[model samples]
Target: MDIKTAAAMHRLRLISLPEAVSFLLLLVCSVLKRTTDFDAVPVMGMVHGVLFVLYVLFWADAWNRTRWSPGRAAGYFVLSVLPTGGFFAERMLRRESEASVIAARARREGVVNA
Candidate 1:
């Protein structure tokens, strides 16, 4: 992959994991507020909201640069809302980025005929 593609994917991967964590924590906090009368919901809500926005921005960047298929793009977009889906998105993207790096290295070193 080119530097721009690589950078975008890297940003997505970096933001996705934390965004997922925050989403999960938000869920927990909301549940606690409802069930246990805890007041941590607002703080966690704000954190998750910020993370979600960042995730969406990064995802859009990656989608544009990568030229992902409609299905792939939808998958990434849908992942933001599902609990634990961020982790899945991160894992999927990690694999993709790693493969891209490997391919770039191989191409640079002329390991495979172009």
Candidate 2:
């Protein structure tokens, strides 16, 4: 992958964990609002919303740059909605990026023709 694609994936990976955390916190806040006086859902909601938007934007950039198959792209999108999916996404992205780095190095060294 090129630098831009790598950067986009890296950025999306960075956002995923915080978004997941916000979602979890929102869930907790929802329960608290029902059982007690504490309520922070609105704040968490906005934060998650922003992060989700950023995730989508970065996802689109990565898809366009990498030309990933629709099925692969969908998998990334699905992760955004599920709890703890961001961690999975990060792990997957890390693997992909590492592979890409190795492939890029190979290409540069002419160990494998592109």
Candidate 3:
């Protein structure tokens, strides 16, 4: 992949784990607020919200620059919402980046024009 696309994907990949953690923590905070006096929801909410926004921005950049198919794009979007989905997204993105590196190398070596 080109630098722009690579950077976009890298940003998304880096944020994935932290975003997931924040989301999970936010959920736990919600439960705690309801069942107990614990009230960290606002702080965790803000953190998760910022992370979620960054994730969406990075996702859009990657989608636009990489020209992922609709299904592929939807899969990535879906992964962002689930509790542990970021981990899966990270793995998927890693595989895609590895494949791109291999493809680029092959092209440099005069492989198929495709």
Candidate 4:
């Protein structure tokens, strides 16, 4: 993968955890708002919204750069919506990035042909 493609994946991976956390916190805040005087939903909602947008933007960039299949792109999009799915997405991205790096190195070393 090229640097831009790798960077796009990295951006998505970095945002994934924070987005997931915000989603979970927002759910908690929603519950608190319903049951108690504590109302953090507004703040959490804004945070989650921004993170989710960033995730989507980065996902699109990665998909464009990597030319991923429709199924793979849809899987990533589905993960963004599911609670705690960002963790899995992050793990999968990390593995993919590592594999790309290894492949690049192998190609550079003449051990593999591009």
Best candidate, TM-score = 4
- Displacement of residue 35 (Cα, Å) in model 3 is 1.7
Give one digit per residue, the lDDT tens place, for model 1 in 46-71: 99999999999999999999999999
Worst 10 residues of 4 by lDDT: 105-114
Give per-model TM-scores.
0.92, 0.93, 0.93, 0.96
Taking the tens digit of each residue's C-alpha lDDT, what string does model 4 give over 1-114?
888889999999999999999999999999999999999899999999999999999999999998999999999999999989899999999999999999999888889454
Candidate 3 residues 6-86, lDDT tens each? Answer: 999999899988998999999999999999999999999999999999999999999999999999999999999999998
Candidate 3 or 2, higher lDDT: 3
* Inter-residue clash pairs, candidate 3: none
RMSD of candidate 1 to the true fold? Answer: 1.6
Estimate the lDDT of model 1: 0.91
What is the TM-score of candidate 1?
0.92
The better candidate by TM-score, 1 or 2, is 2
List candidate 2 stretches off by more than 4 Å: none
- Please identify which of the two predictions, 1 or 3, would achieve the higher TM-score against the true structure: 3
Worst 10 residues of 2 by lDDT: 105-114
Which ranges of candidate 1 are over 4 A from the true structure? none
